[model samples]
Target: MSKPSYSKGLVGVIAGESAICTVGTGQGLNYRGYNVNDLAEHSTFEEVSHLLLYGHLPNKRQLEQYIRRLANFRQLSTAMRAVLEQLPGSSHPMDIMRTAASVMGSFEPEDENPNNEKQRNNQWECGDRLIAIFGPALLYWYQYHKNGTKIETRTGPNDTVAQNFVKLLLQTDNPDPNMVRAVDVSLILYAEHDFAASTFGAIVTTSTLSDVYSSVCTAIGTLRGPLHGGANEAAYRLISQFKTPDEAEQGLLKLLKEKKIVMGFGHRVYRKGDPRSPIVRDWARKLSEIINTPYAKNLYAVAERMEQVMMREKKMFTNLDFYASIVYHFCHIPTDFFTPVFVIARTSGWVSHIIEQRQDNKLMRPISIYTGPDPAKTPYVPIDKRLERSKL
Candidate 1:
């Protein structure tokens, strides 16, 4: 056989085709051929979710109907709520998301027939339902643990996904409109990125013709790693440790001198810079200004200083997670809940990719070149023989 080409971490490997979202294209990221910038600036998170899931931006009547449909699905079944309530308080919020998705699957199992038209349509509805309810599920568990109360999941029918999340999370009837807008835009920015780790994980599960919920559960687990969706939380922790921009600059330099990896400063795909960074940075700046607290101001300053130091010393650019740290902070979202919010937005992308993968169904099985002892020649030694060999 010819020598097998190796790419560590599958870097630069084109594993499959997708039309859901495009990343690192020369013009920047696009979802369903709609530029990310346009979507973030002019659209709501609900609109973006609809665009991503349904394959086109909805007109006025369609959008209103879609929003109502999503709102209707936001309530969790009693059994699902019971599952969330019983999860240990010490559990990582991402784990709560994983368990919640999996449990929801049991309550509402997808049809097993991958080729069934009705089952396919049911998958799309399941995707939408997950996108709508994940926020409520997360907040229900969060409040149940923190406050020892079962807060209502259905805040209202008029709230957008972003608005509903903030309201449910903070237990407030009215949140700051700017804060709501900031969170919404962040959701829009995060709604999709082509073939990201979590999306790929979801795709791999779906390629086996698995249920959509199982695919999303796979995505949540994949995103829990520090190298992926957890980076924002890591970035926030790093930025919060310093009180001043100078201190942040000094701290970053020391870490770099020691050859430590910075959590949010690099990307696997975007060498020029993450196109989403500037947009989120703008929101971070706005939130800092609006809060106008010494701590908020300091955090934003520290983040900026870190970005400058990373670029100056290492020629590395900030990714979305870098500025997103500051944005989530100003929204008053807890540090631990950062990646769960990521899961909520990314559900749209993950489900869309899962559906796309099913359309061009292929089992994503790749062969690995063997480097160990020859399979035919290798013999299994008994425990006694292995022990004797070690002794000799």
Candidate 2:
């Protein structure tokens, strides 16, 4: 008999089909058939979230009602706030998001009946509720730790998620419109990608018929890895080490000589380039000009030089995280909070995947090729009879 072909890391494996997104073999990303670029240019994150979770983009009245629903979901319960308080002040913001989602499930558990329409609607509601609260919970925990003040999470009722996030982070009622728009665009860009590591994790959990919160928790844990969602934070640290474009080029060349892994230069998919990178790069440039601090101005130049060097040297392109770090810095977001913001944006897509998996539930159990000693040749050994590697 012929041995089946094996692909490491599941590369080129067709795990399953998803109607939620198109990536990896596309001109650009699409969420439910809407081009990501068009959504970034013309749609709010709320509208995009609605489009992803509820199928079609909401009409004006429908959008109004949806926003109102999200606004109501923003306030954290006393128990939820207490959980945040108990978490160490030094905890990573991603940890806070994970804990917040778990606590939310305890409060508003997913309905038990997967086959019922109301239960499905309940899952949808949970997704929205998560989107509404992630930023608030993160900011509330942030303010408490940074200032020793238990800040209010609820802001203006009409505020979009981006506006609410800025309001909470800056502790101001009126956030800069440009900053809000930048964040909104970033959220839209980050909202979904087909079968990303974290999204796949969510699907795997849901395939087992796990609850929505479990699936989201699984996704969050997967995204917390540095190679995955931490790229933006890593990219920022890399760029900030240099003061000028020339310095950046020299530094990068040296790092490349050492074979150091650049954090935000390439993608596993997207051979041409990340479509989202340039959009966020434009935002970074615009914000840099507006802010015009010495560091802010220098940052963009250094980043561009780095991009040029990478492409010229290695034929790699900048992914979204490279310029996104600059945009967040100009907006005054703390470096450590970068991945948490990713969690906030990505929760929409994670929940969507969870719901989609539940609709046609199947346990995800893939077989791995055996590489260890053959079972027939290596029978189970008694504890006292097993030889140590040194003896072997």
Candidate 3:
């Protein structure tokens, strides 16, 4: 019997072993028992970090200290800063992040002893290291090339991730309060998804007994492509290319006529629609208002209409990428840094999957029915004898 083709998107098929969270009817995504939408409103990114790491939301006292922990753990090792400073300033932000994460693993390994008391402390520190320094590491290396001048990352201790990141990037302590809130909400929106392609990529990496940094680096690299996390950047590019929804619609129709795929228009999972669309979309809309960008307004209109049209025409619904593009754009994120922010948020899920995979670690090598030439045949080609095949 021939292999049956999947319904094009692995929509309902089990692609691999996953004890990580799962998405189900209505595109509902949860980690453990906590709903993602609820968490986005009620919790900060730091609290969500606690949830993913400790398996539950912290109570009042626990949460207070946990917040303190995140704040206190914000400093980067001097060596790490030095390393970031020394990197050839002309590197891609994602490359800089991946390199920094890997190097951080070398310098800061988490507690490996399964039963060690230091495990909790070590894990928290490790996460704080990633969360706290990721922006500084990328921006420091970035500005070194752009300006040939070193940038100071600390803005005299901004408390929140968004605030600190803005201060670090802008070299100013006076980050807008609303801007920080929006960026923080964006991080919450992106923090976790149930076994997304790149998160699965992280799980598979950890299943090989690799370190967390390596697993996260792998996830980042995997997310940097158009088929996955790169869709946000692609969506931004597409919107930027067109001046209005009318133009975007015309371009989209032309492309569809030519049988070309539109970036961020559809998804493999959401046959009906991505439930996250309205949530993230509204945030972008609000931020567009706050930021006062004509591009944001036009992009929002274009994306909404495109989603409506694509659903009517192709039956493929908009996924997280569509709205995420507008939100990232509103956040003033560089197009290239699109997926790195994704990496920052999704690291929690990556760590969760890493822990899950380690629970019963097994190599994820799947077997296929061998249908190629059998091993018994001995076929050798002489180097001088070649067949000249005509191009079709």
Best by lDDT: 2
Off by over 4 Å in 2: 1-3, 114-121, 386-392
Q: Write out the backbone clash pairs for model 3.
A: none
Q: What is the TM-score of each candidate against the true structure?
A: 0.96, 0.96, 0.87
Tell me the lDDT of model 1 at 52: 85
Taking the tens digit of each residue's C-alpha lDDT, what string does model 1 give over 343-388?
9899999988888887778888977977888879988988777753
Candidate lDDT values, in order? 0.88, 0.90, 0.73
Error of 2 at 131 (Å): 0.5
Evaluated at residue 357, the lDDT of candidate 1 is: 85
Model 3 C-alpha lDDT per residue in residues 1-392, reported as the tens digit of each score: 78745444445666556534556655377656677778777888877777887678889888777766655555667887778877776676778888888878888876676573223336546766687678777777767777776776655432777777766666666777766776777777677776778887887787777777888888888877778878888887877787777887788788889998888776565565666677787787887787776766777788777877777788777777777777777766678888777777777777777766776677777555566775679477687886787995
Worst 10 residues of 3 by lDDT: 116-125
- Give the Cα error of residue 344 in candidate 2, in Å: 0.9
lDDT of 2: 0.90
What lDDT tens digits, residue by residue, belong to model 2 across residues 109-192? 987874562245588888999999999999989899889999988887788999999999999997889999999999999999
CA RMSD of all predictions = 2.1, 1.9, 3.4
- Candidates sorted by lDDT, best first: 2, 1, 3
